[model samples]
Target: MKLDKVSAGYHKKIVVRDVNFEVSPGEIIGIIGPNGGGKSTLLKSINGSLSLIGGSIFLDDLDVSGASAKEIAGCMSVVTTERVKPILMTCRDVVSAGRIPFTNGFGTLKEEDNARIDRAMELMKIKELSDIPYADVSDGQKQRTLIARAIAQDPKYLVMDEPTSYMDIRHRFELMELLKRLAKEGMTIVASLHELELALSYCDRLLLVYGDGHVQLKTPDEVLSEDLLKELFDLSGDMYRKVLRSVRGEKEEGSTSFFVNRACKSFPCHDVPESEFNCMFCYCPLYDTEDCGGDYFYNDRNIKNCKNCGFPHFRDNYPKVIKKLKEKMYGSGSQE
Candidate 1:
């Protein structure tokens, strides 16, 4: 998919500009930004749900800008955060809507439609909800149902806004993993995501839209670089240092399996519910540690048993770590 100079927002003024980017076939590109940063707007523009004032979107060789809604749906499917045209519908009916592109305006499903719907439900792991009333299900289930509907469309291109909106960490990771597997199986996907760490760790590429109208398109590795993240986020000094440290945690030596609980003011892994531990938590030193075992994490100062922690090691030389981090930030600068 190709996005060229795509600019869009309410009232026709561009909230973001000069957004030239491409999504390679069978690759996942994550669109991320601060709230009101035009992340969702960009996705809508590509899916043709929102008209763009200045640009063209192409899926393969087809120009999405000039295509009808049905034509666009023929090549692309979308799962939006907003509940559009939702009065009442069963999960079965919802999933079947994905087959609309091939059906008449009223959508008469064929036998293959039933099979595709089943496959979509199995993929989304929501087959049990097929007979359930979508309106009565929880948001997480509804989100999955809508996604299954999108999957049933079987379009080469899939677009979603905050696919993880109502899911837990495990479910979120599962959804992301599904996208990755689907990409490997030859589907091109672009989704707006709020979970920066997950997107950076999972997506083939990351597209950051800065509030100032500048855009950053880079691989996850390039986006992780100090200069890139600092510029993309307009972060500096302490905040920059903190975020870098968090990002840096991905490179650490411990298991990233951890969680941050609100009350203990600490993240204890031992108590994480099975439903909760769906692998959403990062086990790196950024969040917590797993070496000591049982709910003890790196955050909330759960380093009570780790000897390497800055205790006597940093009793007098504490500034060394921060200083070295700063030097690393400059690429070639030395503390001396």
Candidate 2:
């Protein structure tokens, strides 16, 4: 896939400009930046969903700008974050839609198309839910079903928008792994991600889109520097320093995690049911310092027992953590 000096946005309003990148088969490219930085706009342009304001996009030898919808669908499959309210469709029905590009005008499914759907459901680990109503499934399950739908399309390129938004940490990693496997099997993948850590770890390349209309394609190592992150997200000096330290693994030795949480009783105050919610820290700010110094041991069941330390719960200790982390990163307050 190639984007040559592309510019894209809504209704003639430019969001991303001069975006040039070429990706090969079996590579995963991640588009990342702050909110409204044009990540989605760029993806839409590449997938031929949104018409480009300038330049051109080519999928191999085919011109994406001039291709018909059917031609584009045959070459590229899209999985969006938008929820599809399928009135009476089953999960199998959704996955089967992917075969529409190859189907006849009568929309009859061949045996191979059914086989592809079955394989896709199995790959997404949604075979059990294939017969289930799409409306009855959880958000994470719905995401997986949609991904399966894309997989069944068997397109050369797969595009997604925040595919991990509804997943827990486990399933988030699982989906990344699945995408990597699919890429290795010869599919080109492009997706936008808010999870910087996951993007750095999983994607072969990163496309940074600045809100000011600056865009650049670089490797993960080249794009993840402190200066670049600050510029891309327009972060403050303090926030950038803290993020830099965290990314460099320069935390206070004993501080495992630090977060302020509202102690709402109804908000999973005991255990974490999903990765989006951190119930462990709900009462971290109120823990008995004398009982726990913030150190804990995980037992066979992976249950935490932080009854000997309070290292991460002290709100007043943030400055100390920052100081220590900064010291570790830049060598004991010696400014660079």
In model 1, which regions exceed 4 Å deviation? 248-336
TM-score for each prediction?
Answer: 0.73, 0.73
* Model 1 Cα lDDT, one tens digit per residue, 1-336: 888887877687888888898788999998877778888888888899888889888988888878889789888999998975456778888898888778867778889988999999999999999877788888888888899999999989999998889997778878988999999999998998887777887799988888776677888888776357676666777887786666556433212333234354333432334434322332223122233233433434554323343312221333453354444557445434
lDDT of 2 at 141: 91
Any residue pairs clashing in model 2, and if so which?
292-309, 292-310, 293-308, 293-309, 293-310, 293-311, 294-309, 294-310, 294-311
Task: Report the lDDT tens digits of candidate 2 across residue range 1-336.
Answer: 988988899999999999888999999999889998888888888888899999999999989989998889988999887889998889999999999999999999999999999999999899999789999999999989999999999989999999988888788878888999999999999999988777877899988888888898888788765368888888999998886666554222213354324555344333333433443454343243443344455555554435445444344545554554455557765556
